[model samples]
Every structure is written in C-alpha cells, then in structure tokens.
Target: MTKTAKLYRMVMDKHVCPYGIKSKWLLEREGYEVEDHHLTTREQTDAFKGEHGVETTPQTFIDGRRIGGYTALRAHFGRREADEGGTSYTPVIAVFAVGAALAIALSLFAFGAPFTVRTAEWFVAFSMAMLAMLKLQDVEQFSTMFVGYDQLGRRWVPYAYAYPFLEATAAVLMAGRLLPWLSIPIALVIGTIGAVSVFYAVYIQKREIKCACVGGSGNVPLGFVSLTENLAMIGMGIWMLLRPTL
Candidate 1:
C-alpha cells in the first residue's frame, strides 16, 4: 500500500500560494501520492486555518501525521535551512555574469570579433558601470555601510557618496574612448583606493563584514569576491593607462 500525503493549500483566483506548488512538487518527487486539498474561498481558508489551529497555509501531513509547513518538510528531508538575512552571493554572481555576457555581445557587434584586447576593456567598463549603478541605487545606504571598512570613506564621508559616480563616469568615458587624461586617472585612483581598503579590511584587520559591492541592503560577505572586484578595477585601470604606450 502506497503511503498517501495530504496537502492543504490556498488556491484562490487572485492569490495562489507559491509554497503550496513547491510542497506538491516535493512530495511527488519523494514518491508520495499527494491528496491535495485546495481552499478556494476566503471563508474556507479561514475555516480550515481555524480548525487546524495554524496561522499559515500549505500545511502537509504524511500518513495521518502533521508535517507542518514547507520549512518543516525540508527539515524532515534533512535539507539546509534558507538564510533570511540575504547573505547570498547570488545577486553578485548574476550581475557579473550578465555584465560579462553583455560586454561580449557588444564587443562582437563593434569589433566583429568575440575575443580581442578591446573585449577585455569592454568587459571591465561594463562591470564597473553595472556595479556603480547598484551602489547608486541607494547611495546613502551604501555609504553608511562602506564607511565601516573603507579608510577614505571613514575619514571623508563624502568620498563614499562620490565613489559610485566616479566609477560610472570612468566607465562611460573609457567605453566611449574619450578623454583618457581624465578617465584613466579617475579609474586608477579609485581602483587603487578600493583595492587597499578591501585588503586592509579583509586580510590585515580580519574583519568579517558585509560588502557594499552590490548595494547597502545586500549581505555579501567581505572576502575574496570583494577583493577580486577591486583587483579587476585596478588591473583595468592599469591596462588602460598602458594601452596607448604599448
């Protein structure tokens, strides 16, 4: 006899709970026959919740025993709990990945070649612009968090607010191949400052803090990813400075 699982979920016309769909999929994947009970109306949903003595929907029961919500079901399967603190590198990864793809596409369209010295330049410029945009979204929040580690931001608070605009300007100027004298120095100075700040904060001080790379709200830990971002900018700045000479 196959052990049947019962799932109580809210499936109204205007509101279809996402957890309920996930719960159903999970139960099916686990080889359990699910008896789905949909609370279609508000009255039914309220009545069901009152009867079950539960506050939320998507409740699961296995073999006549209650298994609670999606979190509880995941626990029963020994899965790791999801962090609510937004402490994931997913946003950073997504931004960088998309920027790289866009850079490559732009390079291919402009130079008619996928791999070129110009392509690397484009990649760096795009990355800088994208990162700057993220910071600029909420400059106040970003500056507040940035001052925690950045030496310059700590001393001169306005620098933190100005940093994103500087980065964006440099990126735009470099991408346009305009005013090397201004753009190159801007990139070089900011990149140098960023790299030093990241190194001092992560390596020298050994501080475990959130990175303001993506935004103030993001919880990306200050470490290798942050260091890499600064290094990339520094390398790009140096490359641009030496390109004309080489």
Candidate 2:
C-alpha cells in the first residue's frame, strides 16, 4: 500500500498561500497520495487554527500524525533547511564567476585575445564595476552596514555613501583606458582601506560581521573573500601604474 498524507491549506479570494502549494507539490513528488483540504473562507481558517492550536496554514499530516508546515516537511525528508541570517560565500562566488566570464568574453571579442595582460586588467575593472552596482542598489543600507567594520566609513559617514561611486568611477576609467592619472589613485586608496578593514574585522578583532562587499542584503561573512576582493583591486591599480613603464 502507498503512503498517504493530508494537507490543510488556505485558498482565499485575495491570496492563496505559496507554502501551501509547495507542500502539496512536495508530497506528490515524494510519491505520497495527498488529500488536500482548502480552508477557503476566513472563518473556516480561523476555526481550523483554533482547533489545531496552530497559527499558520499549510499544515501537513502523515499517517494521522501532524507533520507541521513546509519547513517541517522538508526536515522530515532529511533536506537541508535554508539558513536564517547565516553567513555564506555563495553571493560573492556568483558575482566573481559571472564578472570573470564577462571580462574574458569582452576581451576576446574586442582585442582578439583573452590571455593578454589587458584581459587581467579588464577582469579586475569589470569585477569592481559589478560590485559597485550591487552596493548602489541601496546606498543607505550598504553604508549603514559598512560603517560597522570599515574604519574610514565609521569615522566619516559620508565616505560610505561615496565609496560605490568612487569604485565605479575607477572601474569605468580603467576599462575605457582613459584618465589613468585619476583612476589609479582612486582604486589604490579605496582598495587599501577595504583590505585593512577586512583584515582587522576578521583577524585582529575576531568579530563575525556580514560583508558589505556584495551589498547590504547579502549574508556573506567578513573574511578571506572580502580581503581577496580588495587585494585584487589594489593589484590592478599597481599593474595599471606600472604597465606604461614595462
């Protein structure tokens, strides 16, 4: 005999709960025969909640035992649960991966070669530009979060707000191969500040803070990833300065 499950979900005129849909899908996918019950009316939902002593909809039951909600169902099946405010490197990794690929593609198309020193320069510039775009999404939020660890940002609140624009400006100048005198200094200063901030926060202070590298909304930890990003910018600035002499 096949296993069976019961799902009690909300299906109101204004809103059909998304978790309810997910629960039903998960049950069916797991080869369980699901008997779905929709509490369409507000009164019905209220009564069901009161009787079950549960506050939320999308309740599941297996073999006459309550299986809780969507998260619970996932846990029952031994699936990894989504982290609640936990640190992850996924956002940074995705940004760098996409940025590198774009830089390589653009260099190959424009210069007819992807292995030149220009390719490395383009990669750093593109990555900085991309990162600046993320920070610019919500400058206020990013600056607020950034002040926690960045010494310069903490001392001068305005610097946090201006950092993204500065980074973007440097990136654009470098990418366009224009105004090297201004771009090199801007990249070097900001990158140096960022590197020191990351190192102090992660190593010296041993504080566990969220990185503002990606954005205010990211959950990336303040660690090696943040340091590496700053180091790459610093290296790019030095390379640009010395390229003319070499």
Candidate 3:
C-alpha cells in the first residue's frame, strides 16, 4: 500500500518558500505520494496559515495528522540538526573546507594541477589567513580569550591583539612567495609559541578552555586539534625553508 501526504506551501511571484520544496522532497523520499498545494498569493498563504494555526508554512499532513513545518517534518523522520552552540568545531571545519577549496582553485589556476606541491603550501597559507581573518574580526574579544591560555598573550595584552595581524601578514607573504626571510621567521615564532602554549595549558595543566584560534566566539574547545593548527604552521615553515635546498 502506498502512503499519501498533503503539503500546503507558499508559492509567490517574487518568492517561493524554500521549506515547501524541502517538505515535498522529504515526503517523496519517505515513499509518500504528496499532494502539494501551492498558495500562490500572500493573501492565500496567510489564510492557509491562519486556518492551520501555524506561524510558518510548508505544513504537511500525513494521514490527516498535521506534521508542521520543515523542522517538524525532519523531527518526524528522526533527524537531528547539526550541533551549533556551546562547544563545536563547525566554524573551524567550515573555514578549512572553504580554504581547501580555494587552495585547489588557486592551484588549478596557477599550476594547472590540483595536486601540485604548491597546493599543499597554498592550503596552509590560505587556512592560516582565513583563521587570522576570524581573529581580526574582533581583536579585543579574541585577545581576551587568548590571554587565558597563551603564554605570551598572558605576559603582554597588546601582543595578543597584534598576534592575528602578524599571523595574517605571514600567511599573505607565504601565499605570494614574498620575502621568505621575514615570513618564515614570523611563522616559526608564532607557531612555536602557540604549540607550546596549547601543550602546557591543555595537556600539562589540564585546563579546560575555548580555542582562540577560531575567533571571538570561543566555541571551539581547546585540545589536540587546536594544537595541530599551530603544528601545521611550524611544519609549513620548516618545509619552505628546506624547499630551496632540495
């Protein structure tokens, strides 16, 4: 027996309800033959909402039972939304994902190959630059979080504020292959300090804190993953230094 569902969704001249499309897709995916109803005008949509006593639309009916909006439909299908707040790596993941894509695109344009040795270099450079941009978004807020765990950041508050700019400068220089002498040292120094700070604070001292690497939000938990970010910079610096010899 084929199950059937009815969906009431907003379809307007200038705008279409995104959730309505999603609701229809979900119903079909669940093996329900959906009778999709389009409320083509604002007045029609409003009247439908009023009749159903719903604040929003893409309302679904499964066997005469109201299944609510897209979120509600998702719940009915046992789906969970991505964890967003408190402590999560979503922001870091998002930044790096975009960074990696940009790295590939840049590499493809310059080297005509997505997997060139320069691609790896670009990945690190771009990721670092993007991360620095996040910190630069709110220097004051980032410095406040950074002070709690960073050794140099604790000693001099101003250093914490200057750190993001330094990071970004190094990253940009590395990306452009500009002034290896200056950029390499900056990368090495900042990376070494960051790695040592993370090691002592999280591993030795066993302090639980947010990673300032992401941004002002302080949602990403300070841990080995954060340590890897610093390690990557140090590794990149060393690799670049050795590249001229080999």
Candidate 4:
C-alpha cells in the first residue's frame, strides 16, 4: 500500500509565502494530499515550531518528520519524483531521442550540412554530456538547466564556456551508442529547454523570437508550430522522468 503522510507548511513571512504555495503545487502534482495549517499569530507559530523543532516558516513536516523547508523538501523528494517519472516514460523518451536524432540529421542534410553548429548546439551538447555524467553517478538531470552553468545571475542564462566540449563528449558517446541510459536523459533535457524556450517566446514573452534551435540562420516567429514543438519536447521530458529503466 502507498504511504499516506501529512505535510505542514508554516507560512510566517510573506517573502517566503510563495514557498508554501509552490510546495503545495508540487505535492499536488505528485498526487499527494496536503493539509494546510495557517498560524498567523506569533505565539501559535512559535509554539508550533518549538514542538517540531523548526526555526522558520514554510517548514514542512512529512509523516511527522521535521523536513526543513523548500530545499529540504527538494532534497527528499526530487530524486524520488524524478525516478518515479523517469520509470514511466522509457518508451516515450526512446521515441523522443530517436526523433531528436532524426531532426538533427535531417536538418543537417536539408541545409547542405554546415561545417559546424554553434551556440544552442553547444548548449544542447553540454546537456547530453551532463546526462552521461549523471548516469555514471546514478543521478537525474531532471531539467536541462544545470546550476553549474548558471552565470547570468538571477536570469540563470547558460554560459557559452566549455559547453561545446561537454556536449561533444555526449554526442560522441551517442554516436557510438555506448550508453543508451545516459543518452536518453541528455535528449530529454535538451528537448525540454528547446520546448520551453519556444513556449516562453509564444505565451509569456509574446515576441516572435526566431528559433535558433538547430543553429540555422533562419528567423522564425513564435507561431503555433513552435508551441507544438515546445509541448512535444516537454512531454518527452515528462515521459523520461516517469519512465523506468529497461
């Protein structure tokens, strides 16, 4: 039988307010039943924290265990969530990897094969390299964006340093089909970023940014096609997260 656990998020401050809401959303997404207990009064909140040995709001108690806050919860749940999701979408991810390979091949073949693909290409390549690195250590590259590559401060934009080398390693591994396990996660991460970039341009950004996805000089708008591509890639990532290892 599945375990039923109670989680309590103490919302004391407003700055940390979004933490609770985001926590609730994540739990719901993972099919968990969250019961909220709002303690606005200092006396009540202090007493509650003391009882649980918690020193802050947005404190989470999982099955009676005092799991600190957002980072704490992430530490406990992130891998499990990734594992659960990854295990369910093995087939879907395989299909996505195949499709990605075909797209790259076709695009290369169609455009008369440029001497090299740069920028986004390198970023994607690095992502795959990270995947291989993670699989070697039995970790999940859940999202394509790596904290290691975060150099744009609050923007979290990827840096252009050493990305090509990183991705090239993965591409080499992939070319030889040396490790299917590693390649799958790599593809999922790149596909997701591509999809999200396309989506943000369409829905959030609301600007027709050209899809430099494959390193072509083509400037395309944020059209329905881009949205569809984004959704498809995100779907692939979701599936990879859910699918099990074969």
Per-candidate count of clashing residue pairs (backbone under 3 Å)? 0, 0, 0, 18
Model 3: per-residue Cα lDDT over 1-246, one tens digit each: 999999999888899999999889998999999898999999998898888888898899998999899999999999886665668887789888988999899889987999888888889999999999999999999999999999998998888999999999999999877888988999999999999999999999999988999888758889876798899889988988998432
- Judging by TM-score, tell me the better candidate of 1 and 4: 1
Per-candidate Cα RMSD to the true structure, in Å, reads 2.8, 2.9, 3.5, 19.2
Cα displacement (Å) at residue 36, model 4: 1.3
Lowest-scoring 10 consecutive residues by lDDT in candidate 1?
237-246
**Candidate 3: lDDT over CA atoms?**
0.90
Kindly give the stretch of ten consecutive residues in candidate 4 with the minimal lDDT sum: 145-154
lDDT of each: 0.87, 0.90, 0.90, 0.48
TM-score of each: 0.83, 0.84, 0.77, 0.30
Candidate 4 lDDT over 110-165, as tens digits, reads 56653333222432343344333432332222123222222221144332223333
Candidate 2, which ten residues in sequence have the lowest lDDT sum?
237-246
lDDT for model 2? 0.90
- Stretches of model 1 off by over 4 angstroms after superposition: 1-3, 85-87, 109-113, 179-181, 244-246
lDDT of 2 by residue, 38-64 (tens): 999999999999999999988999998
Return the clash pairs for model 2, or none: none
